[model samples]
Target: MVIAVPAVALFCAYATASVTRHLRVRSTGFDLGIFEQGIRGYAGWGAPTAPLKGPGVHLLGDHFHPILVLLVPFYRLFPGPSTLLIAQAALLAVSAVPVTRLAIRRFGTRGGSAIGAAYGLSWGMQRAVGFDFHEICFAVPLLAFSLECLVDRRWAAAVAWAAPLILVKEDLPATVAAVGGYLILHGRRRLGGATVCGAVAAGLLIVEVLIPAFNAAHTYGYASGSAPLSGLPQKLLTVLMVLLPTGFLAVRSPILLLALPTLGWRFWSANPSYWGTEFHYSAVLMPIVFVAMLDSPPARSRRWLPAWCLAFAALLTTMLPLHALADPGTWRPDRAATATRAALHRIPDGATVAADNRLAPQLTARCEVYLFPFYPSAALRPTWVAIPDAPSNDPRSVAAREALPSLGYRPAASGEGVLLFTRSPDR
Candidate 1:
């Protein structure tokens, strides 16, 4: 079963990669940048020097997944973004094996297989795993292990297993709290200890919030400022779509009676700001629901629910190839990378550059770069600025151009809506 999981994951990953590859050559830049960042961070090079910013350490970012940090050393040795991405894909797929085991423990082997397949091929899982270097990919396996331990009533083991999850993303502490609360409420005594451990794990989360805050304060000269939260609704819709299959089964399954409320509370209370930014954080709870639903006593009327879900998923996967071309943005990495590299080559080595928020890190990896909105302590002023053509008409872009003179910056070069700026010594 374990061996089969990787095979299945590899197949799905390849399929996703194939689709994404065609979306645009540059879309892969984010994934590649993440891998590059990991490799650089691991090697003690290109990592953000300020110690705590972005996904590696902040609110809506991941910080606790030690596996990724550990992977850094090995990544340094191996040295290729594609290699890490493939490995991540394999691990994400292999997580289904334990999920299957948990399902089987709750349901029969056949039912467990169905649940495992659903989880393994879940859109959320597929999208996340398909990406090159998300920390969530590593956390998913550990989360599955924690659930397995919980089901076995091994509270100590569960808590210990969940330790790595805390580091993977900041919001995970809330998940730990949720699971720990469930254990304690269910009259599991050792769960008290686990709850305490989870609380301790949460203490580590301060780094996520604090580091970002510090960076914003020190670099941007403000403790807080507004960034667009435009995608919250879309993110929520995506979550609903991803969970539709499991949600349908939950409604019909008695064993999952508690899950409906749990899931509802989770989604309802979620911070709107975090919705789209880190949607993958929801992966941890997915298997628990799958296990509960599968384990429930047979409902004669609803026996076909799992089959229906699988059939629906199969249909979607089949049709994905047809729509692939229409969704150019789906090929994000390749397109983004090509664009970024082109922009990079035009900038002199060590030239300070600022990029669109999406492209900033990629550019940062290739050269000295800063984020727009101008961080006050950014290591250097940008001589070139890269903006996506699509967003050039945005108010922020206009505001940035307006603000440049005030900040002692002048436009130097322009390409495809991206502008390069040089600091004017006579500001």
Candidate 2:
């Protein structure tokens, strides 16, 4: 466990620094703005921060995540989206603590620490770190901590920790129910049955009763929206992505069954996006697989398994783009990045602004920001606009770039492959 702390600390620091650099370089894929704005709203500091996730959608409507409220106070002190990134890093690293403790109890300090290091460096965790913050940061560590409690027979603590996942996302209820199933199988019948019932009740209440109650769109995003039979190859590949780091040994343990909830949802859904290993969708599965690996020791037990796990992680870490996130150089500024910053300076404080996904977070702190197309320009009547050229321009940005001039917004400035447009003063 000792090595786990420092290793996780370093991992968190790397992620925090990388995200800071991402911000400076005008890389907005990290979702810093979406969360920064949302948390800011929860803190009562801004005109409800609107994330650019979906059109005509409230931030709450994007996902039934009240967990954003928890981060409000931290953001109050630090007051940047980077705070969320750093918090996410710290929270994600924490899953290693309980996991390391479990390994230590079974394998002794040295061996357990090695396993913990592998868990800390798992591809899903690393990818999520590079991908930026997600609410799953809370869920990952909570799952680890709660599962550890279950392993140690601390039923109350496990239930307490496991219950809050309902606030994380729509899909977590099933994951929580699986945790109850684990308990029931292990002979804790009452707690197990109770947890299952509570999880189901909470999940239903949130999705069916609570969230849809306030959603502007009057809908919630529970399914992956996948069409029939198309996602099989992607599903198969995603399964490989989950187990390849541990040499596919995570499958041996019954604890690995916990991943089925998330896996089934992702694979069956029509959302082709969920079929890939990128993003935060698979974040919770990492700890499950890794912990299961620790629980089901190899026959030889001569350090072979742990060593192989670490080596496999190291090789993949070197090859993946996420490894680039560990370098401060990844955050260094470029022309388009600088130009976007300069364009922001031209817009007045508190003016309504519309921006592409990558540029929205930068403007969230000072402006009343709206994500383009999602919040129509006619209603937003934004005084200023920023559009990153080419790749960052999703359909919304393309439409805005074409429509802005006709809407009486003319070019204010252009830089970093982004065009800055302002509504004509006379209008």
Candidate 3:
């Protein structure tokens, strides 16, 4: 009951925040729309092609996450972006189960519940729920359970749980390799060696062969040249932040090593986004660190740790996305959002629409949506374009808005900073 209650409470909290974000039109096309397109394809038993990425772009080429097909049946019953949002919330919330159960087995029920609540509200999971959905949601629970099995010394079950991680994302093989290393350290040499070798081979095969084969350019799309050595301080700060929730005691346990492969790639990547504490990148790391803290020598001796974690997480929540729940503005859409939604409704079903990033997810369920200013070539130009009339800092958006008239598009609907345009009759 302790485990189930906290998990259910967390689920309700996460689901409400995510669905509200979607309702307020705060979701973006780059992710929600892209994934919806791919998952919708899967729901219909077709290729996972996401036109929002670019016409006929196979999502598998962009990232190897066939595991998303698992959501198809659920999507069929309730079709929309909110489905993905709520599903992600559930996936992340349920991860607290194993973490809490393990803690209870070590600590008492009250102490276990505190630790579970802290893990549920950890900054990493909060940030992931605030952001749009990603393939990482599946990994969060898998890591939690696999690590739980590891702590219990259930070798076969741990390997079984970790094996499917590779199908979740291309980079997860590194995590799988780390799990294998942990097994070897525990003296399961033969099993651990096979796991490490298999993970390495699978990662190479997926990135070097599979992704490229499906890619339009026949090369890995995310192969940014090299890792930059700049920003060492910021990267180190991120590492420190990950440990702080656990009061830094996680460092004593070898189980903390599981987090290194994930941290390593993110810090080494040329992309700065991966280096930060923001977004879904850190969601997977929360479980690893908390579990390590459980295994740490201090966990038993220092009963105060759970209270500290709970207090810290509570303080942090006041500043995170869930904080919006306390604000009056979050409950109702403002005039701009209402008007933008009105303009979006003017777009007919099945038509191709070039929409602003913020408005794209709104129309994706009923329309073929594309990101404005980056729409396809003239012959393939979207039949409609919708953007906010309010000034944008992005130069491309500014130029695209100015060029709309000259490009033979006329305002079909306009109000409260929202504009919807369509091709002129004679054009």
lDDT of 1 by residue, 1-427 (tens): 5436534854565446633442333334344554455455556654423111332222222233334556666666765455565666666776777767766555556665666776765655655544435676766777677766666677778777766666665545555665566567667757655675665556444453444453433232222343334455665674566457565554443334323433443445435533442335445456655655554435562466557656655555554332353466554455444654475467676565666555554454445444554431334455566556454566766787677677777666666445566677664
Report every candidate's CA lDDT: 0.54, 0.74, 0.88
Q: Can you give the TM-score per candidate against the true fold?
A: 0.68, 0.90, 0.97
Q: lDDT tens string, model 2, 230-295?
A: 867778888998988677777788889889999887777778878888877887988888877766
- After superposing candidate 2, which stretches have Cα over 4 Å from the reference? 1-4, 24-26, 45-56, 223-228, 325-328, 331-339, 373-376, 389-399
The positional error of residue 52 in candidate 2, measured at the CA in angstroms, is 2.6
In candidate 2, the residue pairs with backbone N, CA or C atoms under 3 Å apart (3 or more residues apart, or in different chains) clash, namely 224-271, 225-270, 225-271, 226-269, 226-270, 226-271, 336-416
Writing each residue's lDDT as its tens digit, candidate 3 over 1-427 gives 7788779989998999988888778999979999999999999899999888888999999999999999999999999999999999999999999999988877779888989999999999999999888999999999999999999999889989999999999999999999999999999998899999999999999999999988999888877745757678889889998999989978988989999889888887888888888888999999999999887446364568888989999899998988787888887757766766776787899998888888889988888888888863465678899887778999988888877777778888878567888987676
| Candidate maximizing lDDT | 3
Give the per-residue Cα lDDT of candidate 3 at 386.
Answer: 83
- The lDDT of model 3 is 0.88
Candidates arranged by lDDT, highest first: 3, 2, 1
RMSD of 3: 1.5
